[model samples]
Target chain A: MKRIAYPAAIQALIGELKRLPGIGPRSAERIALWMLQSRDARPLEVSRVIREVQESIHACPRCGFFTTDTLCEICADTTRDAAQICVVEQPTDILPLERTGVFLGRYHALGGRISPLDHVGPEELRIDALIERIKAEAPSEIILALGSDVEGEATANYLATLLRELPVTVTRLAQGLPAGGGLEQADELTLSRALAGRTAVKG
Target chain B: MKRIAYPAAIQALIGELKRLPGIGPRSAERIALWMLQSRDARPLEVSRVIREVQESIHACPRCGFFTTDTLCEICADTTRDAAQICVVEQPTDILPLERTGVFLGRYHALGGRISPLDHVGPEELRIDALIERIKAEAPSEIILALGSDVEGEATANYLATLLRELPVTVTRLAQGLPAGGGLEQADELTLSRALAGRTAVKG
Candidate 1:
């Protein structure tokens, strides 16, 4: 069916909006129309912000998290434990860990995991930078906070072997039943891990 | 707990993105980060389109649908039925009716309905413009294709009473059980409307 052709600019706006993750054609249209018609709508403000982010925001050279500064805020802070580094798959993952207040150390974004099907290897990631940081800082421990997927496991194993010569303790996030998870709802692998890694209750 | 401070531009982008319907803080962050980091992401293109839409698109002089031209495409089209105009609460509604291929007539967007709580009265809508168009064009029929809500009913009734003086047939979209709707799932009012509005299946 031939589409009801919106104005050239409206159509262009819709097409551009649809490029965002999870935004489909209907959602794109709704957003475009809302931006155009609503009295209180601030399309200009949105546009300005988009342009500013494009011009200013970039990956931190040292840690790979987003920042407009020469060095990201986390990297610039002297209070964080420089002797421990947490490795993650993407820069976005840093927030949830930070919110938990569990790790007071620095971060290293791998950019991606080793996915053979997608032709992504360690060379494509920030592994070399991580190694350089490890060598320079000589961190006491390196926490692999990557996902539990097959690719994450492969990348972790590869990194472990490569860093064997370095004088640092290597560890991974524990695999078991997640917090607030039910035994009945837990998958077989998680159940088995929980059983194998169980600890005695304290008095 | 204190939030991880994103760059001024990045935080501003996320906040602006959250203004769009259905986009929350988490989704906003995800989209902003994706725009900043992804190799194929087109923040510039999106920014350009938004600016163009904001600068160019406006209400068409004749029919009130959005257009960059002096007149909307539908109003400019010489082939459409000039004697029949479909009245809608908003410009966005015109597309779905056009997609059905059931209405080849032009459209008149009222811009809004009469909502007392929101302080929107008949004066706020394009009712006067609609009346003027009806007088000038002498349309044979005016179809009210507003929503099935209370405001829609009130607006339709008000329009119908006001249009009683004119020599034209005024009708509304039929309300009944929707296409492919099941009797078990339909509400009481819908079932009753369907029963009352029933017609014999044609051969």
Candidate 2:
């Protein structure tokens, strides 16, 4: 327990901060102290936002990305090509590609890839939804925007086999970019490599 | 504004985090996301804590440090000697000396030092309360456990002058620690410098 009153709240804030990829307990406390520096924090107006998000935000029903609405903006846009679904793991990964304004299509957010040892497998993902979506929309192509890692490759291979009989083209993202980095952290050249190296599959 | 529900609340969280001594916008967003990751963060819980702190946690009526009641733990502890009031800038600064278990006395948090550039002067600080505390407690020694900076020196000098007529010793924490270096970050050798170089106040 904190020797102070806001200790729990501060600790909670730190706990939340630690969930981020690089942050730790010390960094989290530093952040909480920083937030508490201003006078307006007395309103808990800052803390309320944290609690409100815990109370309201949820995954986009269609894309699995955090969104307040039922569907993400990308999924809701009717002008975009619904026949091409660019699949990715996290929402932050969508920004860089979106900045390029190159691909115009919808998206499918697989919660994560196949890593049974890590307890993340096909069941934990939205694979069934993708299949259902493919059967319903009959997208011309299903872009595998997963990382070029063991899990990514396993997921892509499984999906290709599952969608073999479908009319839609099943393809992996291009290679030569990197083998293990997430789409969010990949450089433009690497992303371009994966994008360019994309090859058609027998399935 | 966050393009999400309760934009004000989200903005408030971001603003509050930014107000913290060192957080940036990206970190603020991550903290917000972490809170949103769970539902135990009720609005009542968030708001109540803030209100409770605003109402309950106040400057110890005597020492100017945080206290749940009128008097802080240091001031209330009957076993401690009342003749020595260790003056510090913030409540957190008192911890380092406490860890050493070297001092057995009360404390006075000045809240801040004399900094003309930021317009933080004697009036803006708890210097008056410290003076009042000195008069009331009549400590034999007043240790200025403050930062090793111009502001600290100025404040210490000013306090020494104010207490010149009083039959008490006003000693500073020390000086060779170097300007702008915090006690928290300084090595053991540097800290010893501040302690060893301490001398009698001219005033």
The DockQ values of the predictions, listed in order, are 0.59, 0.29
lDDT of each: 0.89, 0.70
**Clashing pairs in model 2, backbone N/Cα/C closer than 3 A:** A34-B20, A34-B21, A35-B20, A174-A194, A174-A198, B83-B139
Task: Write the residue-wise lDDT of candidate 2 on A1-203 in tens digits.
Answer: 11223334444555655555346777756654544444564345555655565555677788665566777667766788888988886654565557667778877878778888899978888999998999888899999888777888898888889889889997766576456678999888777877877778898
Q: After superposition, how far is residue B172 of candidate 1 from its true place, in Å?
A: 2.5
Model 2 residue B107 CA deviation (Å) reads 0.5
- Model 1 residue runs over 4 Å out of place are A1-3, A195-203, B1-3, B182-184, B191-203
The weakest ten consecutive residues by lDDT in model 1 chain A span A1-10
Cα lDDT over the full model 2: 0.70
State how far residue A31 of model 2 sits from its true place (Å). Answer: 3.6
Task: State each candidate's clash count.
Answer: 0, 6
Please give the lDDT score at residue B142 for candidate 1.
95
